[model samples]
Target: MLKIQEIREIIKLIDQSSINEFTFEQDGSKIKMKKQSQEVETVVRNVVAAPPVEVVSTQPQPVPTQQPVQEASAPKTEETKADTSNLHKITSPMVGTFYAASSPEAGNYVSVGSKVTNDTVVCIVEAMKLFNEIEAEVKGEIVEILAENGQLVEYGQPLFLVKPE
Candidate 1:
């Protein structure tokens, strides 16, 4: 049987690494940990003729769950350090992979100097295998692209900077 402390330590190590899954087995006990949506899900099993059970630990609380991408908080960056009072930031509504274009062969949703209205589809953020079209809620001209294509963006992370119209 694995001790709670040992399990917690293993979780800590896995949490710090980028590996999505980790598994261990010895004797008749087995443990599997998988990461999903930034939170770790653990499954324990026993090969012996015994009922499998779940062990809960309070040391490492799961991070708050995130909702689907939508407009979120915009953090200040180097570009914002400049006099950007007249600028508007297009922030990610959820955590996902940011894509500048709809597909490899398609044109980017928006580019620097591109004029956009409040309803313009500025980019697509892929979350949970679903492509979410992100809209520019404010009229502006694209001034900068803060996130790279195929980059993992966090909730409220600035994806673009625009000079307000």
Candidate 2:
């Protein structure tokens, strides 16, 4: 791990250099420092689950057959809100990963057309290893779930659209 003094030195070096950003990675720790117009931004993330790399292969290999699933729903969610402005939206209060259930094996807290009270927990948002239960403050039936399961949601991003009864 890099020391605080080392980080300070790096920041000082970045300030002196012509480069606007600096990034370094060692083992599983990654650090990114960027200079914005108003301030300096620093982001850090640790990824610890990598297998050991020992052998080098010279032969050409075929690409993996499994395809990645990308969620193309953010724009559609915006369109949905625009189309139905009468509905009440349950937006996220913080940036986190949206989860429909408490656990992977559990049922979703709320689904489309599901009746909900003001105190109902409609979803869970996990931020920095903490799971936060999100509530539906409006008394209504859930009309649409704007975010997909396990999707990353930003602050004020709509999670559910509800139609008041």
Candidate 3:
């Protein structure tokens, strides 16, 4: 069981950060918390069980309705409207640090309105111990560069938005 103060502190932290998820473990118990929009949900799964019951003679009780509980715990999904025609995004193939140029002193591989061929090296992503040069898959003019230089990026994260020729 968590103290009320601890639960309040976790809620405070969630309100102060951009992180949508948090988990804490202590004293053989774990609590997972998530916040979405204006709602917060917490699930506590205890590892230990209470003592088993002895022989009982009481009559069975009616089960409570679970519809409200389910409604309260449902996850919310946010939708964004995007124009897909004429707009194609270049995504990172692997999780790594994105570099806009070969080095800090070098010119960027591609910029807005830069014409690119299929084999043009658009950027480099450093993964593990190697720096992999990312090439343009389609001949086009770059309309946008989504990722910043020397930024950590996740797999499938959008790196550039291109308008195909």
Best-fitting candidate, measured by lDDT?
A: 1
Give a tens-digit lDDT track for model 2, residues 1-165: 688688776665555434578788997877787776545566666667765333221222233343334345435677775768888889999977899999999999999989999999999999878999999998999988888798778898988989987
Cand. 1 TM to true fold: 0.57
- lDDT for each residue of candidate 1 in 122-146, tens digit (9 for 90 to 100): 9999977799999999998998888
Q: Arrange candidates by TM-score, descending.
A: 1, 2, 3
Q: How much does candidate 2 score in TM-score?
A: 0.56
In model 3, residue pairs whose N, Cα or C atoms come closer than 3 Å (at least 3 residues apart or on different chains), thus clashing, are none
Worst 10 residues of 2 by lDDT: 54-63
Computed on alpha carbons, the lDDT of every model, listed in order, comes to: 0.82, 0.77, 0.75
What is the TM-score of each predicted model, taking all chains together?
Answer: 0.57, 0.56, 0.51
TM-score of 3: 0.51
Better of 1 and 2 by lDDT: 1
Ranking by lDDT: 1, 2, 3
